[model samples]
Target chain A: MEKIIGFYPGCSLEGTAREYNESVFSLAKLFNIKLEPVPDWNCCGATAAHNISKKLSLSLPARILSQAETAGMKSLLVPCAACYNRLMVTQHELFENEELKSEVEEIMGMGLNSPIRVLNVIQFIQEYIYPGLQEKLSSPFGKKVACYYGCLLIRPHDVLNFDRTEDPQTMDEAMKMIGAESIDWPFKTECCGAGFSVSRTDLVAKLSGKIIKDACDRGAEAIIVACPMCHSNLDMRRNTIDRLLGYKTEIPVLYITQAIGLACGLSVKQTGIQRHIVRVDWQRLNSCLPEKMIKEEEDIHG
Target chain B: MYYALYLITLLSKYMAKEIYQNNAPHTLNNDLFHEIGISSARCYQCGKCSAGCPMAEDMNYTPNTVMRIIQAEDRQMDLELLSSESIWLCASCEMCISRCPMQIDIPKIMDYLRQKSLQERLQDKAANKSIIPFHQSFLDMIRYTGRSYEVGLVLDFKLRSKKIMQDVDLVPKMLSHGKLPFLPDGIKGKKNIQAIFKRTLRKK
Candidate 1:
């Protein structure tokens, strides 16, 4: 069966996290998974909308879900964890309150009666992509990675309810299938001072510093993430994090899709690995791939 | 067990009434509860929420204290909680509500306080002035493009907050990596987004 899921790249993927967007598309193609982007999807309200207006926060994500339904997609793949949380939370709130549902539908001028399943990137891989990942892999990535869930992916377990809230293993499990050794770390689900990546780099420095330090102390070579917010805090704000650490930390943060793509013999350039601020040592990771696959990658990338 | 539960409820009401009398005179309708649809009075002063909060150290009042203030219905206390940096600092991590024995949604309550603070124009009086303008810029970006435009959001936030140099150094680096696009893109259904905003106001 050809599995097709609606994709909502969200705003971060369009702007700050285009690398994430590129890798997700490439990985989906590699897995033979078909993705149809939801037409003209709006923002998911992220961390700001609720502060402005609760109705807008609910209505914005509700509109996206309705759009997915109208597009004839029963399952929507939201790669950004924040967007997934917003969509899932809106559904949970609406299901519990018919009054709020009607109000949201009226406000957005759309009906959300058709059930749409919202899956985060990790869950999408675990369900559809994981089954055939081993046969597709041309390399055993073999790098010790710290799987970071940041704040939203699994918290408030009742609403998001995809994995264990305190100790999520889905990302780790996926990494293992790609031949990367995932490390057990304390900061897996810790807050990396998300939106503060831009507004308050100092706060991000302090929070993300702890997460990076823990990953390094545990002997991980790189950090794996599903949220663009976490990637920005961990990768883009590295200078602040390093400044606060009083030493340089060279741990590269890779979106899980990029990591999976690399293990599946996707070119580093194809996976957007070079776009990261903290430069990833792709040469070291490439040696873990099958020799023929490495030659092929060199031929293609060179 | 039933008798004890009833007694505890009565005691809480009496305690709340006593606190209301000593504070500023404002009728405590069920507005906060109605807005959040969760009762803070259900919180039994458990420090679990505070213990699990990643930003609790930065908060002047812990999550439990904020809940107590709302439960007491003290106008002065409510204002203090609303104006504190803590409410703005919450990442909405939802650790509190998930761990709450009473299943109280403390994050929702904090969101309500933040909303009330913004509505009442208390941001200038609050400890964190940085988030106020950023929030406005974010909403403005959404209202314009039906989604966030990163470069536009940064420019608008910097201009509005007057923190022009905030992360200015990262602009060139971001541009080099294609992180910051100079042009903003709009969804085709932007008019529908504008309609959503307009309807939200009338509903409010």
Candidate 2:
């Protein structure tokens, strides 16, 4: 029997980051792990609720956790860093304040029952995929990449308590396991002006441009990330980023799952590589793989 | 000596009366402490938070200055901090709290301050006008569809902010890549989500 974990892709994964959704499912299929979507799950409210109302922030996540608990799920995999942070922080806040918990319960119309364990993409990979990753690698992804953790994945240390706040190494370690040389670059945990992507694209351009420039200057071929928001800022906002830098920095951003999927012999389309706004340099990525795998991929994709 | 002691007591009582008369500062401070359990008084002007803040350069007042304003415990300073663009501009990256020697949760305080600013109708004083509208549009989408509809959110934001021409060029590209879905994927629990919103608002 395969292990089943509740999966919450969040809003971005369904829309702007559909490629992330495809890559995550494809990678999970290889491991035979069943990623069950939490039934009738609503939005985690993201940055909006917290900015507007504290009660809404706690209540939104509490409802999602309750749904997961009702489904008999002991663990949930929240791939989006923002959702993961909201869920984890909500649990911590509710546990610390009984008054708030009861108020949230009243709003949720359900008892905040057994706390479901929430896992981000990195933690999920570390637990289930990393253990069996070595045996499944068909070819090493021999490329230098910067692992961008962004914010929310590891901050408010006492609440999330997953990785180091500054210069996090978990994503780097995971990238190394898949045969990619993780570069030592600053801005691993920098804010990409996340929620400001739509409201203040200029700010996102400035902040994300610095991250891209640093990665390129440090000789990184690609920037790998786990968050869709970071992927959007680095990949979707490439034109703006380039405008800010006064030159084009054509470094493609790949999700961690997509990078690992390539190493595990998944096709480019399967990993949703073509969905990216910044055209991925297929020739360069192919050059890093084994010759036979490259031939096979070319025959199928070409 | 007896006369001197009487005069000292009179001076102390006068100062206490003057401080109590100006109750706005304590109300703001006490509200923050009671709501979030974080006191701005804990900030000791280390400037570490401001130094590490990514948005400090863009903000009207740096993170430390906002802390100092709250620490001053003056009515004028409280209004200044609340109306300042620093609160609205905070990305809530938690860099300050992570490195603070006193472990002050600046992001949480920013959230509280933003809510207070809106409640008091001090949002007009915010220099960065689009942030609040974006947040409102996002929540509105969730409240309606029980999920964030990107197309709806962008349209709603554009309507609210009246920046209609912004990002128009990216729509075709997004559509071609299937990044922007024409329709929102609504959850079956839409009614439940609305109820949650209503209940939270009623409490407020």
Candidate 3:
């Protein structure tokens, strides 16, 4: 029997991070885990709600959790770090304050009767995939990559409480599991200007430019990330980042699932590698694959 | 002579209180505590928040300065802080709260201030004009479709901010990659989502 877990792909996964969605689902299929989408799920009210109304922020996530509870999911796999953070923080806030919780319940028109575990992509991998990852690996991803945790995944430590806030090692450990070297870099957990990606493109350029520069300076071939926002800021905003840096940097940003998928014998198309705006160099990644897998790739193509 | 000096001192103190009362309606510190249960009084001029802030360079006032201004508890300073662009510029990265010795929850305070700023129609005072419109556009998408629609959000933001063609080049690339879908995937619970928005964010 396959393990079943709730999956919340959030808005970005549908829109700008379609590759993330594909890679996540493909990895789940490979791991024999079934991802159940929360039925009729609404948005988690990302930064917009919290910035304007506290009640809306708590209520939006509360509704999502309520739906998950109704569906009898013990644990929810939120691939987007922003949604994961919002759900976790909302749970914590509701648990701490009965008045606010009831108020949110009234607004949501549902009761969050049971607590459901909200897991980010890193935690999801650590929980379900890491145990059997070694047995399934067909190729060792022999490359040095920077594991960028971004802001939401690690900070507000008391609420999410997944790993070390400043210097997170969970993604690094997961990278190491797949035979990749996680580099020691300063901007691993830095802010990528988050939702400001659209409004303040210049700010995203500056902040994301620093992260890309650091990864490149440390000789990282790719930057591994779990958040859609971080991926977009680093990958989609590459031209802006390059302009800000006064020189072009070619480090491709890969979702952690995509990196793990590659190691687990998934093809480039399977992991949606072609979706990236930065243009991931397949030749560079091909060199990192095991000799057997490389020969198999050539045989299939030839 | 001693009694006269003592009486004058007491009178001056009373007059000062009256003058302060006449000047400002309410202190920002008390309002923040009442609104969000976060107290700026705990912050003791620690610059750690500003030091760790990613956007401090572009902000009109740093996080520490905002906290200090809130602690001042004066009406003018509170209004100034609310209307200041610093509150709007906060990325809510939580770096300050994570590292602050006091654990002041500056992000929550920033949220509360942003709400107050919008309520008082002081958002125009924000120098970084595009931030609020982007947030509004994002919420508008969610309100209608029950999820964020990137193309709609971009169009709405462009219209609101009038800074069209800022990232016009990325749209074609995004469309080619199948990242930007022409139509939004609306949830079945669209009405419920609208209710959530209407109930929680009631119009002033």
Interface RMSD of each: 1.2, 0.8, 0.8
Off by over 4 Å in 2: A282-302, B1-26, B125-128, B202-204
Clashing pairs in 3: none
Can you tell me the DockQ of model 3? 0.73
Relative to the unseen true structure, what is the C-alpha lDDT of residue B114 in candidate 1, on a scale of 0 to 100?
82
- List candidate 3 stretches off by more than 4 Å: A282-302, B1-25, B126-128
- lDDT, residue A237, candidate 3: 93
Each prediction's total of clashing residue pairs, residues at least 3 apart in sequence or on different chains, is: 0, 0, 0
lDDT of 2 by residue, A1-302 (tens): 68889998899998999999999999999988999999998899999899988889889999999988888889999999999999999999888888888888988898876678999999999999988899999989998998999988999899999889887999899889988899997789889999899888988999998898888777788899999999998888988888777766678899999999999999999999999998899466424333455578789999
Q: Which lDDT tens digits does candidate 3 get at residues A263-291? A: 99999899999999988884664343334
Candidate 3: residue A41 lDDT (0-100)? 84
Between prediction 1 and prediction 3, the one with superior lDDT is: 3
- Model 1, span A1-302: residue lDDT tens: 66788999999998889999999999898888889999999998888888778999999999999999888998899999899989988999897899989999999999987668888898888888888988888988888899999888897888887788778899998889888889988888888998766666677799899998788767688899999999998888988888888767778899999999988999988899988998897456423233455578789999
Measured against the true structure, the TM-scores of the candidates, in listed sequence, are 0.89, 0.91, 0.91
In candidate 1, list every pair of residues with a backbone clash: none
Interface RMSD after interface superposition, model 3: 0.8
Candidate 3's TM-score on the B chain: 0.84
Q: What is the C-alpha lDDT of each candidate?
A: 0.83, 0.87, 0.88
Ranked by lDDT from best down, the candidates are 3, 2, 1
